[model samples]
Target chain A: MKQLTELHAMVSKAVDELTFPAYPTDLYEPISYILSLGGKRLRPALLLMACDLFGGDVEKAIEPALAIEVFHNFTLMHDDIMDKAPLRRGKITVHEKWNANVAILSGDAMMVEANKFMMKVDDAILRRVMDVFNETATGVCEGQQIDMSFEQRNNVLIDEYLDMIRLKTAVLLGGTLKIGAIIGGATSTDAQLLYSFGVNLGIAFQLQDDILDVYGDPEKFGKQVGGDILSNKKTYLLIKALELANGDDANMLDHWLSVEQFNATEKVAAVTGVYDRLDIRNYAEDAMQTYADAAFNALDQIDLSEDRRQYLRQFADNLLVREY
Target chain B: MKQLTELHAMVSKAVDELTFPAYPTDLYEPISYILSLGGKRLRPALLLMACDLFGGDVEKAIEPALAIEVFHNFTLMHDDIMDKAPLRRGKITVHEKWNANVAILSGDAMMVEANKFMMKVDDAILRRVMDVFNETATGVCEGQQIDMSFEQRNNVLIDEYLDMIRLKTAVLLGGTLKIGAIIGGATSTDAQLLYSFGVNLGIAFQLQDDILDVYGDPEKFGKQVGGDILSNKKTYLLIKALELANGDDANMLDHWLSVEQFNATEKVAAVTGVYDRLDIRNYAEDAMQTYADAAFNALDQIDLSEDRRQYLRQFADNLLVREY
Candidate 1:
């Protein structure tokens, strides 16, 4: 745990060193602002962790790790615009703070900057890094598109929803691990195992997010409890609830889903009632555990000894247990 | 000229053959639609032309050429949203045809696709190509930022506007030629020269566009004769007019600029009158010629024979002589 915190601090310092010119401050300011409004630095830490686990020089991996984090934030910036999200991590989003056009252009600049960082590696591995990075980047865009499309849709299948989250969230995480593994000179087989570990862990992480949105303590969650319910976001819990409900419960869910206006508290309470009756929380937890177990299973494929793997297991457990 | 036409046809065919999945039609349909609504294909053609001119196989350069064009179109799609442009190449823009969110996401996808195509090059020169491409890409975004900033201000200088356009419009052209040169095994010095040629020619091309917006016959221009004037766009002619105009003429220009709404034709005619009195057209033409001459001089640095150089000269002349 201490080592993870140190790794995160290193990532933060590397990110801080990334400065842009003051002029065209509108374009670059948001980039600097968003990077400063730090997240958990999980992606970059995962990258370096994966590299170090594979016996690669952690120092050499810092820039690419930073690149992954920048790319993730770029996605967040643009997605917030598309989502019309006013806030991210409890701070006003770039689009809301400045404007959509600035957000769009700045996000575009960040993506380029991400590529620049990815390219800073030795030429021997640059192409490999880019291939993974590009694939992950495009998958993320596709995931967001599908996610948007699902919002306008009512009949989103559980499989389709799962696929969407996998693309939208999981692949990049997996790609981050895979990137680190490649840079670490891990064998292809070991890299694939780490990638699988990331994918499954990422899925579990997102499923946990779905659960937290509804059941989490408001103070700890850092967001409005049941915000997704208000927005009619067809998350896994809602999809499963819809699939399992019947008669009165089905009609109630439909009414809440279709209602254009309702008291926020009432809507949330009534929906929570339906979720409770359906025992969707238990179902969600089980699903999350299933994926987490699969993630652990992937770790079994790696050639690392029992002790080295314990850190990743502990990290995943910590991620799963986070309230926010 | 014939070779250029042939090169263009090849580019069009290459662009047409590019396909995407039918599902997520909202995301990809716009991509296919935009590529189908062909523009001049000038950038890609220049890429191939440079490759061939340097004794490289044009076939090997096609994907990178397409990548350049795709990146260019990606910028166009996003810029259209920012500019609130409803039409592109006489068709409804992606934003209008679908929606802004669709345009934004599809543009993002197109950028990723552009990189994917760029990565299809032989590994020998991938990093070299990516370095030039990334620098050009970031410059284009910065150029756009400055252009937007200018729109909100009244005192945009000609020098600043020139710099903005060079970043916004010229670097990609320069980068395309440079990428082709690198792929064709040209020396770094020679590649740099071709890049300079492309940059100067691009500036000249854009200046011609400004001139045509005010002075060229409407029939041949294929766009509104005074579109820039109507929109209060800060073009070279307008900036120079502001720089040179005195007393009543300056007041007239200011009045036209500040008016909330007016007869479009009257405003265009009034602005053109100011430009004509100040010899802004002549000034713009002279400026265009200076850049064109610089481009030609860049070509002189290359060791190509007179016959080979004449093709480039003729291509530039054809570009300059276009009425639209």
Candidate 2:
């Protein structure tokens, strides 16, 4: 099996080689700019890895893998505008770099481009690939819509939050892997098994992200320790804490959430204190473990060489146990 | 062939039957709302007509025709946001009725839905339909970008203006016809001819729209005459007049364009006077007729029964010589 790093390199090189027309500078430039802004290229790499797991031609999968990446960035470009985020991956966002209009139009174009790329497979599988891709794309939009709606809502449930992440974040992971597996000539059953593996792992990864946001070393995590708390971002921890906290802890959490302004450090500390008292960390970790275990179970059933299965398990393990 | 009214009814019924999921009320409702706020359903009807012209099943073409309509509205939803337009079709625009973020997200979803609808064609023709659809979709976005960019520049050439209108308005019409022809099992050559016919006709229609905005009776035109002049929109007339006008006429036009504050009626009257002095309407009409003739030339070359050919000719004639 190809190593994860090799697949990542292939995805990066392909992204770099991507070109757009020279006219309509505003529309095409933002697209090129966003794609050039470096990320882990994780989704495409995983897509290639999934393809490789089925002994598929990794080269043939590059464009489809790029499709996954482009779609992901398209989401980011639009999300940044909605979030009014000034920066992405530590650079000025497309909307901010140009304007929201440019970002919106470019994002729309990117989506069409993504679909065009996804259509690059053999005709036999084109329909299935598109079915999966469109469903995945639709889910991501729904998830974002749900995420936005959550901001005005104070009564979000744990299940709803989980479902939101599943749609917004996890499904793309699962969908990419499934597409790759299909391209690799895996049976429908095996492709579905791989999809389940990616999805559950994705959920676990997001759960871990919630945990690390408040608890991990800032240098290692590469973000503010309690940014979600500061923003009242309605993460799994915040939702669970709201559900579980009582009396003084509840009052304190409520105060923090409602206040128009406060000392950032103190709010973070107080919220973390509430979370600590409620043992929200353990609850979240348990939930994370459940999904991680589910991922491994799905992985165990997939038909592939033992070593290849182990390789995926290792990748999942590495993903979950990142520098936190 | 079905009557135009019959084809239009079929499109309207298909649109009304379109159902979106209920959970994400904000995301899906705007889509339904926009779709319900109907236009003439011209593009889709033309698609079905094209299909019928090639002896294709109109029933089979319905979903793809709806795709065209959905895509057209998707552009409108986002364009309304970009233009800060408060109304569409005498009703509140999606952005104005809901919000920009809602409009943006819903529009994105609508585009995906358009593709989903486009994918409903038979498998053999799916790739070809999608290629045309994607290229068409991308062209519309590019056209919008160019149109937006024109607002910031003074030297927009007549050719550039024509190109912008082609990409923004004409290509979809052309692409729709081509897709319809393909679904009807037309030969590649016949499909190309149909495409050219739609595109050239579309350009002619838009040119007529520009002229009518200046010269038509307000009662018959259904819009405030000279609206483009009042907004300083860079239409073919404006660009050509700027190129052809001399000395005092150029100075007067330049003054009106640069002024931030003016009486809307007086500005329209003054601009119409300049247009009259320069005979800009005739220039625009000449250009419009050139495209109309090109469209007829293409239609004449397509391998269709004489009756079907005459039906299209009548349609084009009726379209070009509207109430104005």
Candidate 3:
């Protein structure tokens, strides 16, 4: 199997060659813009890695890889509009750069473009890939809806939040792996096991994201530290803090949550203090490790030899260990 | 082939039986609500008609037929949001009833659901249908973008308007016929011919709608008469009037176009008078006939005999003849 760096380079090269028509500049420009603002290309790399690990032709897996990449970006574009996020990857988001209508329409075009990319594979595998895609795409939408509803809601349960992330984020990762496995000619049993691995890894990845938002080194995080706290986002840390605090601590947390105005640094410090007092950071780290271990266990069930699985394991470890 | 009425009934029944999951009520509820708001069901009817015309089993065509119907409504939902329209089919639009965020997210899900429905066919047919659908869906987006851009510009040429409508409205109708024909096992030649037929019919259908907006009886129109004129919509009649009028008449039409405020009735009446003076109604009628005739001529190129083709012709004629 190619090294993770090699697979990531392949993904970046593939994305560089993607094109859209020039007539409707409004619709296609944002597509080109968002895609150029690079992420880690982790999802597509996982897909390619999964295929290669299963002895599948990496060349044959590129289209589905691109499909997932484009689909992931499409979700981000729409989510930015819904979140009223002004910046993406340190650049102005499509909606902020254009307008909500342009973003909505361009995002719609991106979804179709992703599906068209999925259709590039041979007909033999197209249906299976599509089945995985349909379910995953719908789940992402449902997850977004649930996320939106959570803003207005005060009684969100931990389980509900987990399910939301699972549907919105994890399933697509799982689906990417499954699509790659199918293309790689893995047996259904092995593919299902890999899917479980992806889901666990994905959950761990998001939990780490929550942890990093508040705890990561500023130079490494690539975003404003405590931005979530400043926005009063009910992250795993905040939720846990709220659930566990009592008396004056509860009132302090409630004051932060209810206030419409506050100094950003002060609020961040106050929230972080509450989280530290409640041991929320440790609870989150433990949760992340739990999922990470579950992912490794699922990987162990696969029929591949330990040598064949080493690269995937190393990739997961690197992802989880990253300060950013 | 079933009678047009029977085919429309089939389309309606298929839509009735279409269901979405119960969770994420915000996402799925708007989808169900929009689908339940009945329109002409013309696109799906055209699809089934094309399939039946090619001797394909109508049952196999039902799924894709519903796909087109759902897609049509999805477009309407987003269009209403873009146009700031409050009503669709005498009921509040999804955006009005719920909210823009709900409308946008629900519309996104509707597009995915439409694709899922398209996937219900055999894999062999699925790829071909998807090719048509992906192109048509992207074109619809392009069309909407161009239409939006036109709202900001006064120099929208007649040819540009025609192209926009072709992409936004006519291509989808043409795609419906082509998808049905492909599924019905028609040769590429016959499928292309049916697509042309649908395109011509679609153009004529939209022109007829423009005419009816200004000229049809209010009792039968089910909408405010001359609504397009009141809104300064650059329809064929208005475009032609602006093009044909000279001297004082041209100045009057320009005045109406530039006005920031005016009595709705007075504006409508004045525009209708200009159209009457310029004989724009006849020009529109003649253009509609030109397309209708072209549609019939394209139908003539297909393999079907006169007996089999008569119903399609009658359907087109009836659609064109409607005053409302």
Candidate 4:
């Protein structure tokens, strides 16, 4: 089996080689631009890893792996527009660089391109792969809608937030693994087990992100600490704090959330103070570990050699143990 | 073969019966709302008609037909936002009613839904059908992008305009017919012929629309007479006029096009005058007839019985022979 780093490099090289039509510059250019502004390419690498783990032909998996990568970027392009994000991976976003209309149309084109790539699979499993893909894609949209709706309401429950993240972020990871496993010629049961492992790990990763947003080393986090708190974003930490805080702590949290203006450091310091007092970090960490453990348990059940299993475990460990 | 009316009714009924999940009302509601505000369902009806022409089971074609309808509306929803259009079919557009973000997201979900419906095809043909669907979809997006690009440029050629219309408007029609023919057990050669017929007919239909925009009876034409003139839209008549006019006619047409504000009726009349002087209407009619004849010639070459050929020819005639 290929090492994770080797698979990642392969995916990156394939992404670099991708080309789009040159005529409709407004439509195809943004697609090329967004794909060029590379992310970690983690999802596609995991897909290839899953395929290799199952003894499938990794070379044959490259195009479908690229499909997952393209699909991931497509979602990011659209989500950037919906989120009004100006930057992606430290570069200007497609919508900001072009316009919303261009982004929208180009993103639509990317979805078609993703599907075209997906059709490269052997014809026998085409239907099953597409069924999973469509469901995953649909869930992501629904999750985004729910997440947007949460912005207007103050009553978002923790479970609902978990469901939202699972839909928005986790399913794609799970679906990516499942597609790879299918391509790798794994049994349906084993494919679904890999999907479960990916999902739990995904949820844990997002919770890790929530924690890192508030507490990670400024140098390593690559974003402003407590930015979520400054925007009153309904992260798991904030939601849990909202549920558990009361009296003086509640009043302080309310003031911080409601205030129209404050010094950036002051706000972060103040909100982080509230979280510290309530030990919301511990609560978030506990939830993250629970999911992480669940992911390992699913991994344990999969029918791979211990060496390969340890390889996946180490990958998950490295993912969660980001420099902080 | 069932009558066109019967096929159309089947499509409408199928569309009406379509339902989406009720949660995330912001996302799903716009989808249902836009689908409910129906057009003629012409694309899907034609799909069903093509299927029946080849003696395919009409019932088996319903889901894919609905896929075409949903895909068409998905384009309209996004296009309305890009065009900043206020109304569609005399009702408020989805973007206008719900907001651009909602329209964008809902349109995205609808695209997924369209693919889901597309997957209902028989197993043996799913990949082939999807190839056509994705290619058709990608072309439509490219066409819209080119059409939008033209808004900022004055040098859009007649051939480029034709190409844009073909990509944006005609290919979906052609692709729809081809998909239907494939489902109806058509040989690849026959399917290509039907596709050619649809493409030529679609171009002719669009040209007829351009002519009607200037010259049709205001009462019979659903849209405001010469609305395209008020907007300085580069339709065939206007493009041809710009190419053909010189001296006084050139100055007048340029003055009207470049003017920021004017009485809508006067602009329409003056533009119509330019068209009359250039005999642009006849040019448009002759071009339309050339395509119409090409469509008939392709239809004649198809392997279908003469009776079935006449049925399709009659359908195309009625489509072109709208009230005005």
Model 4 stretches astray by more than 4 angstroms: none
Q: Which one is best on lDDT?
A: 2
Off by over 4 Å in 2: none
Candidate 3 local lDDT, B97-195, one digit each (tens): 999999999999999999988998887778888999999999899999998998887777778887888889999999999999998999889999999
Query: What CA RMSD would candidate 1 show?
Result: 1.9
Scanning candidate 2 chain A in windows of ten residues, the lowest lDDT window is A303-312
Report the lDDT of model 1 for residue A2. 30
Instruction: Give lDDT: candidate 1, residue A65.
Output: 96
Better of 1 and 4 by TM-score: 4
lDDT by residue for model 4 (B1-324), tens = 898889999999999999999988999999889889988898999899889999999898999999999999999999999999999988999988988888888999999999999999999999989999999999999999999998988877889998888999999999999999999999899999999999999999999999999888878877788888999998988889989999999999989999998988888888899899899999999999999999999999999898998888888898787847
TM-score of chain A of each: 0.95, 0.99, 0.96, 0.98
DockQ of each: 0.78, 0.89, 0.85, 0.89
Off by over 4 Å in 3: none
- Report clash pairs, candidate 2: none
Candidate 2 structure quality by residue, lDDT tens digits, B43-66: 999889888888899999999998
> Candidate 2 - CAPRI tier?
high
Q: Report, in order, each candidate's fnat.
A: 0.67, 0.81, 0.84, 0.88
